[model samples]
Target: MNTLRSLTLAVSATLLGACTTLAPDYLRPDAPVASAWPGQTEAVAAPVAVADISWRDYFADARLRELIGIALENNRDLRVAALNIEKAQAQYRIQRADQFPSVALSGGQSAQRLPGDLTSSGESTISRQYSTTVGISAWELDFFGRVRSLRDQALETYLATEEARRSAQISLVAEVANAWLTLAADRELRDLARETWQTQQKSVDLTRRSFEAGAVSALDVRQAQSAMERARADAAQYASQVAKDENALAVLTGGQVPARLLPEKLIDAVTALAELPSGIPSEVLVRRPDVLQAERTLRAANANIGAARAAFFPSISLTATAGTASATLDGLFQAGSGTWTFVPQLTLPIFNAGALSASLDVAKVQREIQVAEYEKAIQSAFREVADALAERANLGEQLDARRNLVEASAESYRLSDARYRNGIDSYLVLLDAQRSRYAAEQELIAARLSEAGNRVALYKVMGGGWQ
Candidate 1:
């Protein structure tokens, strides 16, 4: 009883000393980018903060929202990310278990026969023994905080993994939105090409009739036919592009894209997607998933320093058991059969060829590396947000200018066609006007697509949605 009481007191004293950790105090690294966003004055303002907005609310199109939902469910990358979190959680639990002792119950019976010459007795003898024990194995006492430090490191790693999953989700949402927008844009381009082809075909027929009547030369008819064929070729190219865009979107969704969810026209699709607010404060970048993940990685590195430092100190461990022993199975729990064992060990490192110092230095260097990575993550996020905001500042103006140019080109073509019909314009002049109008129309559609895609980019960079 006296020995057991002394053992308990010793363990209590060791645990009290476990509170000290060798790791240096953690400090968050400073942001390495500009504090304020550039070109903020030109950006549009909004009442709500972007991070508070849900993806469904930000993407107003019902089809887009449905597609995002399906992607969230079926996307293999996202599923793997979620599974990684589970795996990390289990790993953390395993590491945490080391902080405490594990008790196990064991029982066994043995029988042996001894030869007459080896036995103390003159005759051969049979012996039987039985025993049972319940005890902790070689559990560390953690007097130097080694186990605690390792547990903390594991916790930080698990947190970093969770942040990585969030980052994956953010990337997936952005990719799906971009793919859907691209499909809409290509579909619009195809329609525009078809319309241009039809109009040029009519012009070709009219020019051929005029040539047959000797009102226009063969060169005039050939120019008109050439324009018609170019438009037809453009139509075919855009048709192939639209199909390819659908395939890309389907891959993103991880399944076939439903026909009902496909955009009918680019303009309608652009109108359906709501514009994102710009000029968000640069400090919001700290909340980005990649940045947070880097910070967690830094924390894990810091915790490793504690483990390395603890290696220079003495390690204490304890193993104990209490049970019963007897010659017969019926006598196992008898009053006089009680047995017990207690072992306490301490190991002090003297010299190991500077191995401990090398380990500590390695840990410190790794922590420094993590610090740089965390700062870089913040800087990268800042640049992405800044670039998106800069684009948002001018995309509206560019789209408006392109629309006006398209309108002017169409008017010029209309006037030139009237002149050609009345024999007041050359075939070259009319052909130039028609080609200019078609090109301008295509540019306008491209500009609209850019404007819409810019909004999506801004939302993603600002850490909008995925809340």
Candidate 2:
């Protein structure tokens, strides 16, 4: 009873004193980027941060929302990230278990024969021994906080893994949106090509008939045929591209896309996506999951340095057993059969060839490496946001110019065709106008795609999708 009481008191005292670690006091590093985003502008009213907005509200397109939901549930990359979090959680639990004593129960029996020459009574006899024990084995008394530091490291690692999963989710949402938008743009281009082919075929037929009537040169018929074939080839190429885009979306969503949800035109898809607020600040990068993950890793490394420093100090352990033992099974539980043993061990480093110092140095170096990586993550995130903002600043003007070009090209084609019919212009002039109209239409579709893709990029870099 006394030994048990002593063990309990020793553990309590050790725990009371083991509240502090040798690790340096943690301080979050300042963000290594500009305070304001490039080309900042003031807003008349308060604007909401993208991180506060949910993806469901940002993407007004129902089909896009559905696809993102399916990707979150089915994407293999996201599934692996979630599993990593579970694994890390289990590892942390295992490390935490070491902070407390492990108790065990054991029972045993022994029998031996004694010859007459070896017996005090000069007789042959059999001796029996029975015993049972409940004890804690080699439980470390963490007077220097080594075990506590290790526990802290494991907890930080687990938290970092959770942040990694969030980062994956954010990336998955952005990728699906981009793929869906690309498919929409390609479909619009494909449709435009097919329409241009039909129109050129009609011009080719008209030019050939004019040549037969001796009203136009053979060169006119050949030029018209050439334009028709060019449109035909473009139509075929875009069709194949659209199919490839669908396949990519399937890979991202982990299943085939329904026809009803497929987009019809680039403009429709672009308009369906909500506009972002204009008052974003660079400070919002701190909330990004990748940046958070990097900081968590740095914290884990910092904790590891404490464990390394603790290794240089002496360690104490305790092994004690409380039980009953007797020569016979019936006597094992008797009053006099009570037996107890206590063992306390202390280890002090006398000389280890400087291995402990080397270990501590390694830990400090690892922490430094993590600090650099954390800063890099912040810088990369800031650059992504800055680039997206730069692109977005001009896409609206580019879209407007593309629309005007398309309109002017269409009117040019109309005027040239009328002049040709009235014998005031050559077939070559009309062909040039037709080609311009087709090229301008393709450029407009591309410009709309750029505008939409830029919006998605801004939303992602602003840390919006994971919500």
The best candidate in terms of lDDT: 2
Show where candidate 1 strays beyond 4 Å: 1-17, 40-47, 268-282
lDDT of each: 0.84, 0.88
lDDT of 1 by residue, 3-56 (tens): 665786678677976466788899998888765788554434446667667788
Model 2: weakest 10-residue lDDT segment is 40-49
lDDT of 2 by residue, 1-467 (tens): 67697767867686877556888888988888876778865422226777878888888788889999999999999999999999999999999999888889999999999999999999999988999998888988887778888999999999999999988998999899889999998999999999999988988898899999999999999999999999999999999999999999898888998888788887544434457764445457888889999999999999999999989888888888989999988998899898888898999998999999999999999999999999999999989988998998898899999999999999999999999999999989999999999999999989988888888888888888887
The C-alpha local distance difference test score for the whole of candidate 2 amounts to 0.88
* Model 2 C-alpha RMSD to native: 2.2
Q: How far is candidate 1 from the true structure (C-alpha RMSD, Å)?
A: 2.4
Return the TM-score for candidate 1, rounded to 2 decimals.
Answer: 0.94
Residue 228 C-alpha lDDT in model 1: 90
